[model samples]
Structure formats: structure tokens, C-alpha cells
Target: MSADNRIIRVIKGRRPKVVVIGGGTGLPVIVKSLHEQNADVTAIVTVADDGGSSGIIRDYINVVPPGDIRNVLAALSDLPSLYLDIFQYRFNSKDAFFAGHAIGNLIIAALSEMKGGIFDAVQQLSQMLKVDGHVYPASNTPLTLNAEFTDGTTLSGEAEITGAGKHIQRVFVTESDLNAKEPPQAVNQVIDAIMNADVVVLGPGSLFTSILPNLMISNLGDAVKATKAEIIYIVNIMTQKGETEHFTDADHVRVLNRHLGEDFVDTVLVNIAPVPSDYLDHQKYDEYLVPVEHDYQGLRDLGCRVISADFLQLRNHGVFHDGDKVATEILNLAFQVGTMKKRRY
Candidate 1:
């Protein structure tokens, strides 16, 4: 097809979508950038967190923790204004009922209760945020992540599993054998996004804990593989000490393949720049911020195209990506390069 014809085709009939699969703070970072870049982003967030606010919500109120979902919402909230600001606020009074609670989390939990389902709750909030894209819990049911340790002991929840300090032999959900009702909005939206998407991006976040948890759900792994969209795996800039201690770029992929299988990913976006060794002094081996000694060639040999760049965010008031810079790269990947996936062009 001619360039004009291709562009016309893309504009006329194309979805030019992006389906991001993961959870934790990083997924929203990707979502924020891509939403700005104008990819019809559909975030399939992991619902397996059994920690902190989310864990409390799940155990006490029998609802999915709104923390990560709230993060995704805030990230995609239309920039510089009321929606984002109101949702991102945390209560201050220690004696207050809302103390230590995020307004977003409260909103989502309330919506879930009124709407009578997690999916509807998210929809209600998304409409309010005017978020640039869609967000869904990977599963509708509040899920418990079950991890089997190398020592043959099984941890019952995500927080417990991660906190147990054991080498995870394999991780799976409690009702793995049960057929889950896919959050209708989530399942259909993700499938539809995939069929029309120009790119599907995964990770730069926690490996087993965050990313794979989503890929394991809603039959999402199968849907992703079935899509015609180019797939890109963005590698994390630093190693997460306890979860990814002494890991390299290749180790990340290795873990992905181990759970989801070897052919699960196509391309990996890696940071090629050298960080000052002084940065390493802060990255203790005790807390999951060890060095990410990347093996680019190994990933390439594994059939993943390693797209290199200076993909790091400088230190700031908050410890995360500079949104504008990351958004620039996201725009390039989605609109400029189309994709770096080897099979696409």
C-alpha cells in the first residue's frame, strides 16, 4: 500500500490502539504517556495485590483494591485540572475515617458497591475522569495470588507470597481451575483493542508480581497472541531487589517465558544509557533495587528486538519517570516508528 493509502486506511478504518497489560505504578506511567500520544489505550490491570490499602479493602469490604486502578485512573486523568487533583489526594487526619485513604480509592470502592460490580465501578469513574483510554481489572473477582515456593510451601496471598522471602517456584491463582466470569467490559474491550491496535505494550515494571499477573488473566495471554498488533516489552531501568535481585534484561524475559511461555513477547525496549555508579549506592540489594545488568544480545537471540534508548527518569520530588520525556518516547513508538516489532513491517 502507498503511504497515503496506508495512512488513509489507518485513519479511516484503523483503531490504532494500544493494549497495556500490567499493574503497579509503572503501568500507569505507560498509560499516561500513550494516552497523551493518542493511542486508544486499554489497560488490563492486575488484581492480585494483597497488600496495604488494597489488601485491607479486599479482606474487610470484599472489594478489589482500588490503589493500582486508582493510579491508572489518575495517570490518564485529563491533564492539569480538577479530575486528577481530586482523585490523587490522600487524607491527612490520622483520626478521620478517611484518614490515609486516597480519594480515588474511596471513589472506586463506592462505585463498586453502588454499581454492584468491579467493572461497572471502573466505568463510572472513567467517565468522570475523562480518561483518554480504558482501564479494567484483569479479573472481576477479588483474586488471591497463590505462589508455590521452591521449598514446596504454598503462600496464600500476594503480599504474603512476596513477603515470605522464599524463592517462588511457580505462581498461580487460587481458583486457577475455575472458570472466571471475565469482566465483560474488560474482556471485550481488550479483545477489541487488540484486533485494531497498532501496538500492544507490556511491562517495565515488577516481573512476576505486577506484569505476569495480568497476562495470566481473562485469557489475556491468548488474546494478545491472537492479535495482529505489534507487541513490545519495555524493560525496567533498574532491578527490583527482592523480586528481581541480580536480574538482567534477559532474566526479565526468562521469567515472562517461564510463566506465560517463551513465545509470549516480540520486542523489548531497553535503556542503553549508563547511569552513574553513585545511583547504585542508593539501590540496596535488600529492597529489590539491585543493578539491572542487561543482556541485550541474549534478548535478541531469543527473538526479541531490543530497542535501545536513554530510558531513565532523573531524580525529582517524586521517584518516577519524567512524564513529558516518557510521553515523548511513547509518542515515537506509537505514532512515529509505528512500532519496533520485527514482524510488523
Candidate 2:
């Protein structure tokens, strides 16, 4: 169905509940678009980040990395643009102690300290920012992402794993706290959102670091696999050199299924539009190597419904998914799922 018709249908019924799971710049783009579509959006942000200001904060404060959560908050916030700009502001290198730190990250760190937990801190800040949707941290505490590479060597930390430059065999999460014996798990709200969602979306972010960190949390992955929500994977526009070099779209889905022990993805959104030659500024996006290759049959063999389209958006010499187009497709699928549920009753 057309996006216009889907929008009309959605308006005549209850808003679709969408739960987007991932981290990085790509996630906020989709979350913001879903919020614009009037979907009841919930973002389950990865807390395994251990780089930049977030890493600094994690080392010093021993709290969840606030970078991704801060961006997701800005995306869903109904606050004025100026306020968001200030919240998102980064200190210059000259500002020694605060250099590279975002204002929102500091605020989140402070709140996490005062509120006694990152999840509670984010929720309190959400209300203050007049956020239009929920933003839940993947865990209450910091998580260290661990990877076992094809060479059988293991690495801990998201930064270390990515920098190792090895073909990853599989990845998992562990509590950053050495003293903590318990396994990592998402808070109840995150699991509830997944189970109750009309649609659950993953990716447009790093396959291992960004998306899978949350799923590596045992119960959260179980909820996703067992949930009735139509799971959608937005295949990345380009394969990353260190992570998924020479990977096809089906290879992406394959890795996801292998990790979770099930072929749980219901739909795969692949970008068919070709990027203009010489348009990409490689220095700015050094990690991305080449456009991901297509393998439709492989995807189908894994029980995925492929939806390839012109979902590409080229801007400022960077390639990205067109947020509006992707959101439209998501909403259409969500509405279809909703309709089917109603008919069954």
C-alpha cells in the first residue's frame, strides 16, 4: 500500500507501537522519523559503547555510556531546536577536562549519579525535555562487549573488538563490573516494550557493536525471538572494513540469526538505489568500505521477506538511509500487522 494510504489507516486506529533497537547516528534518524509518523516509539539504546566522551565517563563515573542515549533523547524531544543544540553541544579541545564531552552526556552522567541509576536518570530527563517517546538504556549499568574472532582469539570492549580488525565469529555482552557475577539483562521496561510492540526494528548501525550488544543480553534476545512483533532489519547501506567487509545483505541477516540461534527477522529492508560514483567523502566515513552486496535467495532461504527500494539519501558527500522513506515502509508493515491481529479476534 502507498505511504499516504497507510498513514490514513493508522490515523483511523490506535497508533502503532514501534520499538527501535540499536545505537549510533543511524538509530536517532529512524527514531525521529517514527515519532513524526505518530508511532508510539521506544528506543532501546546500546550501552556497550566505550569510546570518546562516553568511554571517558564510563571509566571515571562507572555509569552507562550516555552518548547514544543523549542523541536518542534529542531525537524524540519536543523541546525547541536551540535547546537541543545546546544540549548536544560539544566542548572544544582547548577546554581540557571537558574536551570532547557533550553537554547532554554530562547532564546524563550527573543525573545518573543523583538518581542512582542510568535508566531512572534518562526517564527523569525525558520528562524535562518533553520527549515524545520512550528512551530506555539497554542496561542499567555499563556493559563490556566481547567478541570471539574467526582466529579464535577473544577481545573485550567495543573499541578493542572493532579495532582488532579480525573477522568476528560471534559476540556477546558481559557486565563491565568485575565483581558482578550476574549476567547482563535489560530492564523490565525494555523487555515489555519488545513483547508489546507492533513492530521491532533493528539496525542501519554497526552489525556487531551497535545492534547486537542489546540482544546479547539473554532475556532481551529471548523476548525478541519469542515476541509476536514483526521484526525488521534495515540493512546497512555500506559494509564496514573492520566489521563486515565483503558482506552481502543476506550475510548480515545470517550473522544476526546465528547469534540469536533462530531466524527471527521477519522483513529485510535493502537499499537498491546506487550511490553516485565519487560522491562519498571517504575520509569522513573511513569505516565504510563498499556498498553491501545483494543476496535475495539467501535471505529468502532464511525466511525473510525482502523489500528492496530506493531508500538511499546522499547528502554532504555521505551516504545514509532516507529516514522518511524507511519510516514509511516500517509504518506500512506495522499497520498490516495490526490489521491481521484485529481480524484474528
- Maximum-TM-score candidate: 2
lDDT score for candidate 1 against the true structure: 0.69
lDDT of 1 by residue, 1-345 (tens): 111222121323443567787888778877776666555678878778877666666666867778999999877776556657777888788864667778778778889999887878998788877776788787766776777788899877766766787777667754422465543223566567665666677875677788877776646776777766667787877776446667788878877777766466677877776666554445333343644787978887778877777776656312344444554554455553343333432
**Number of backbone-clashing residue pairs for each candidate, in the order shown:** 4, 0
Clash pairs, model 2 backbone? none
lDDT of 1 at 265: 69
lDDT for each residue of candidate 2 in 1-345, tens digit (9 for 90 to 100): 222423333634578899999999899999888887778899999999999999998889889999999999999988888999999999987767988999999999999999999999999999999988899999998999999999999999887888888999999999989899899988999999998888899987999999999899999999999888899999999999779999999999999999999889999999999988799999998888889999999999998999999999999899999998999999999988875642111
What candidate 2 gets wrong by more than 4 Å, as runs, is 1-12, 342-345
Clashing pairs in 1: 240-288, 241-288, 241-289, 242-288
- Candidate 2 matches the true fold with a TM-score of 0.95
